[model samples]
Target: GLNTADLPAKVLANRALLCSELGLADQRIAAAHQVHGARLRCWELDEHPPRFGSGAERSRIEEADGHLTHAGGLGLLVLVADCFPVALSGGGQVAMLHCGWRGVAAGILERAAQEFDASPVAFVGPGIGRCCFEVGDEVRARFGDVPEAASGRMLDLRAVIEARLLAVGVRAFEHLDLCTSCRSDLFFSHRRDGGVTGRQAAVAWLD
Candidate 1:
């Protein structure tokens, strides 16, 4: 499929093609217009069915950086290139978050944690690693208390997120150590590609 971040006609065509190929044509897939914020949206099965692939339906999907739902059959999706895609699931509900530096700084993970019925299990996906995600002093200042926030100028987002997960009481946590910028053959990187690149998706659903 094409970059999940783009919803142009071609991207939509690619999405439809990919869905058909994956036997997901009948699935209700929800997506959001990510603004690198900490906004989270909740979904109900009948009232908030996913609207991601079609032109008309796409217009109605909300603009948010994260999604949570206890409903089965609805897939919460997040698009990422260099940013981490985190999934939290437990107690019958699930949340998928697009965790970039800005979103994380804005407490996106903490916000998602509050929606779970129990202490959720967390899975942090591939993203730009510390070796590649170098940031300036200003960005690092935002995470002043995070011990793993930076090594000199290199930012370790996984470390930042892991620390927060622990603080939020999520113990059963796992993180994919892969770096998007380092593994060009397997993933895309907004920084590595100079801001013009495709995106991979992280999706979660019940049942």
Candidate 2:
């Protein structure tokens, strides 16, 4: 569900379940108020004091679409419904990004690449696919005249993201290829469910 929604109790409960499975404490989870921009925040456990539990919840970073950290045992989270959740890890660091069309157009992937010291393996999570993500000329224009991104009027969001990551020197890339819009049983899609829908979270942390 929408883990960072106004419902703090429900959000905490959902997080608790994930932390239990991962053998992590829910208090160490860090999140942001994603604004569909290219801004990325990097946190260090030594330099910046770790925020945990209710403190972390209260101090959710604002106006950032991406988060990166070298801090071990600290979870970074990004919530998405139709937007792609891009996770990157390498050289003892990890990052999670909330990438929407606006974020892609604004160069969020490239901005994220700047945060990594070495080539990172990228894992792209599920989102709307080209089959159902039809768009107009404006959206298509942002990604140029690439065939993979433009299937008639449909836009392949995943393709655009993959191209961007590759261009920024990410070699090892994996995509979940699951279309949230089509897989009604497994995902939440803003397009398929209209404006009112819950969000699925993509979370990553260093071991």
Per-residue lDDT tens digits for candidate 1, residues 1-207, read 232445488777767775665455434777888999999989876755555676666556677999999788677888999999999999999999999999999999999998876799999999999999989999999998796578998999999999988899999988888999999999979999998888887888787
Write model 2 residue lDDT over 32-151, tens digit each, in one string.
777889988887786432333353545454668888899998888888999999999998999999999999999999988877888899999999998899899888999993557787
Residue pairs in clash, model 2: 27-53
Model 2 stretches with alpha carbons more than 4 Å out: 1-8, 47-60, 145-147
Q: Tell me the lDDT of model 1 at 148.
A: 58
**Each model's total of backbone clashes:** 0, 1
- TM-score per prediction, in order, is 0.91, 0.89
Specify the poorest-scoring 10-residue window by lDDT in model 1: 18-27
lDDT against the true structure, each candidate: 0.85, 0.82
Colliding pairs, model 1? none
